[model samples]
Target: MRGEELQELTLEELQHLERTLDVGLSRVIERKEQQIMERLNGLEQKGMQLLETNKKLREKVEELAEKQAVTDHPENVFNEDAHSSESGSLDCDDTSDTSLKLG
Candidate 1:
């Protein structure tokens, strides 16, 4: 077929060769499409898994942030109205105010 002795082949032989080539080409295209579909499915599954993992990580991060906020500000841990005496005694310390004034 590559410019090699094409004149020797009769018209019938050329037609047969063309049919064979067409069948082979069709099979090749089918196989290529199958592989592409498999790859696409794999990538889609991986993307879903990553999205789930990201969601879980985001939840964990929010949990940690909430814990950290509570830890950083301890006032939320207690209700002053319920423990008025304890809060009043704690207020006597006033250690949170660390300012110096000279007049």
Candidate 2:
């Protein structure tokens, strides 16, 4: 209200106006609190989802590591027939020619 209008109001009217404003301010504060609580709940749910995703990713990494370990082991790579070749000797099949042909 303008200064002239506010000056026209009696003491009782000013007290009533104060009470109305207090009620409006309380409602506004309550709505803001509710909004904050909702946002907090959303953030908590997102955090849980991220944790679950991280767990799944970790498990996948471990599984891949185990598979890689089996494939990358020296014994597994060179010993498919379960026999160790003699040192300095070439293990070859008799049916196959060992010489390289030049064209």
Report the number of the highest-TM-score candidate.
1
Candidates in order: C-alpha RMSD to true structure: 7.7, 10.1
lDDT of each: 0.83, 0.80
Q: CA shift at 103, candidate 1, in angstroms?
A: 28
lDDT for 82 in candidate 2 is: 51
TM-score per candidate, chains pooled: 0.71, 0.65
Candidate 2, 20-97: lDDT as tens digits: 888988999999999999999999999999999999999999999988978865433446455455565556668855
Candidate 1's C-alpha runs over 4 A off are 1-3, 78-103
Estimate, for each residue in 1-103, the C-alpha lDDT of model 1 and write its tens digit.
Answer: 4547878889999999889888988999999999999999999999999999999999999999999979976755756575677445544445656665456
Candidate 2 — worst ten consecutive residues by lDDT sum?
Answer: 74-83
